[model samples]
Target chain A: MSALELAAAVFLLAGAGFYLAGTLGLLRFPDALSRLHALTKADNVGLLLVCIGLALLAGSLRQAALLLLVWLLALLAATVSAHVIARRALADGAEVEVRDGGGP
Target chain B: MRLGQRLVRGIVLYFALLLVWIVLDGTGDLVVGGAAAALGAWVGLLVAPSKPVRQRLLGALAFAGYFLVESFRGGIDVAWRAARRDLPIDPHLIRYRVSLPPGPARTLLAGALSLLPGTLTADSDDEGALLTIHAITPDPVNAVRALEARIAAWFILPREGAEQEGPT
Candidate 1:
């Protein structure tokens, strides 16, 4: 494979890894809120990397712009939904474990 | 002047929608694209009458840069923690009182915090006075505060007199 193709493959693999890590976080995190963080942040970065890889592979500016647009919309949806879920959990009095010190 | 402002907004929205149509259509068909864009703009105007706030372009660019960097950091931080078998996390909620007004600015702040480092805006009171933010880190107060300042500066909201300092 060409060097560019190799680069794209590497990005795609990294993106998939991030997505796997996000799912692992969702399964392993202690509570709803922490899990929300895992899902939103990790998935966002994962999708972003995937989009970039795909855009590079596509090699068309218009398609790249559209891919970026899709990423933006997904980011928006993820942010809004995650906030809503977290808010509901908090309203339900989801227990939170607070630690002392190490805060400025 | 208000009519003129609305007219200008309508034209801008028309062109923006038309660009989207062209991108989606991918055929350079101006006639259909123009009609669709016009319809879309009219529907947009009818549904959302209020004009968006004037954005400072430089400030927005700066905010975007900061957001991108912070989001990257946030993703790596979470991934690192998730990778650890020990699961080092000290989750807590803090009722953070922000200074931004109760409309778009406040909403933007909440959205920004959720995607930032180890912090998520779980809930805010009815009056938007206190935000119940969940943080994986021990101290998210300073980070939240810094984000608040960044947003305030980005939107060019007045810092004095309108400040509503609530309990932390």
Candidate 2:
């Protein structure tokens, strides 16, 4: 495989790792509040990295640029939408129940 | 302030936005584009009939900052819930009565509530005096109570009429 191909693979793998980390965080975190922090931050970063990797692998400047634009737009929309929804949830009054074992 | 100052501020903000857009798009020719955008915005603002709402800059900024942080927190919470195999969810519909009257304040409250984890705006009736919410985690009473408390803090008003009831 070419150097570009190798770089693409690495980026993709790194992104997959991030996604896995987010999933584990979701499962392992004891409380709702803490878990939220782990999933949102990790998954967002993971998806971004994966998109960048795929864009690089496209092997054409025009195609890569288009992919990058799409990625950027998607990220912006996701971020804004996430923020809006979370604010709404807070307004709706959700709470993190205290664990019996006193661990977050 | 004179009309000219308002015009200048609007022009500046518009031009700045256009420039940012150009950089992101990589169109490479910004002078003409920037001028066009600024002119368009200027004309639109001049023709717009509605008066701008008066907001205390500090208060608005604080509210925005708080909303940004809370939304981030909420997004993570939702993602976690979505990934779980055993959905530890207690879905229920709740109606919350709020203190803010039916204007931007109430709309803002409703909009903000729609973002948090496990809660969706089933309906917002009577200009946001009442909000029907579907929550994944249930506990309608407490959810409404907490939501009201947070909103009250953000909007700087005590939610006097806030109450919640579980769906039938």
Candidate 3:
């Protein structure tokens, strides 16, 4: 395989690994908020890597830009949804393992 | 806002929507696309109203570049922390009061903080001044401050009394 193709494959593998790690975190983390860390962070990274890999393979600037747009939209969606869920959890008084008081 | 300025903003929004349509729907008819973009801008004006912003071009570019780097680092950081067997999380909810005034700038900050690695904005007060964020890092200070600076750079904010972080 060409160097570019190899690089794409590596990226795709890394992306899948992140996705796996995110799922493990979701299953293993204790609380609602902590679980969200995995979903938002790892999953976002996974999507970003996947997009980069696909963009490299697509070999068109326009398609790469489109992939980037998709990832950004996904990031925005994740941010909003995670915030909403966390707000609801806080309102329900879900157990906060620790809380540092208000700081700058 | 002045009527003239509002008209200009609407026109800009219309063109932006037109570009989006053309790019996403390459084969669609031009007439229909134009009407749709116009309708979208009008509806957007109502649903997602925006205030006049004093954004600096170079500063905005810097912010974007900084954001791209930080976002990638954030992803890798979180992935590493989670993948470890130790888990090493000291999760907590903290209240952070941002310097930005309540508006799009504040909202953008909140959204960004949430998307970053260790901090997730959970709630905000009615004023949008105080944010309740879930933080995993021992010290989110430096990172948060850096991000705030980047965002502050993007929108030329007026200086407050003593904490003057003037446009950079």
lDDT (tens digit, per residue) of candidate 3 on A42-99: 8888998899999989856667877887898999999999999999999999877555
TM-score attained by model 2: 0.50
Assess the local accuracy of residue A51 in candidate 1 as a C-alpha lDDT between 0 and 100: 88
Task: Name the candidate, 1 or 2, with the larger lDDT value.
Answer: 1
lDDT values of the candidates?
0.80, 0.57, 0.79
Q: For each candidate, report its DockQ versus the true two-chain complex.
A: 0.49, 0.08, 0.55
For candidate 3, the per-residue lDDT at B127 reads 69
Candidate 2 residues A1-104, lDDT tens each?
A: 98888888998987787677667766765544434444555565567668778987875665666666665566455444544454466567756332111011
Query: Per-residue lDDT tens digits of candidate 1, residues B1-168?
Result: 377777788899999988777666775798988998999888877775364555577888888899888888888888888889998877887777676766667888888888887999888778666677889987887887777667766675554524656333
How close to the true structure is residue A87 of candidate 2, measured as C-alpha lDDT? Answer: 48
Summing lDDT over every window of 10 consecutive residues in candidate 2 chain A, give the lowest-scoring window.
A95-104
| Ranking 2 against 3 by lDDT, winner | 3
Against the true structure, candidate 1 reaches a TM-score of 0.89
Chain A TM-score (model 1): 0.90
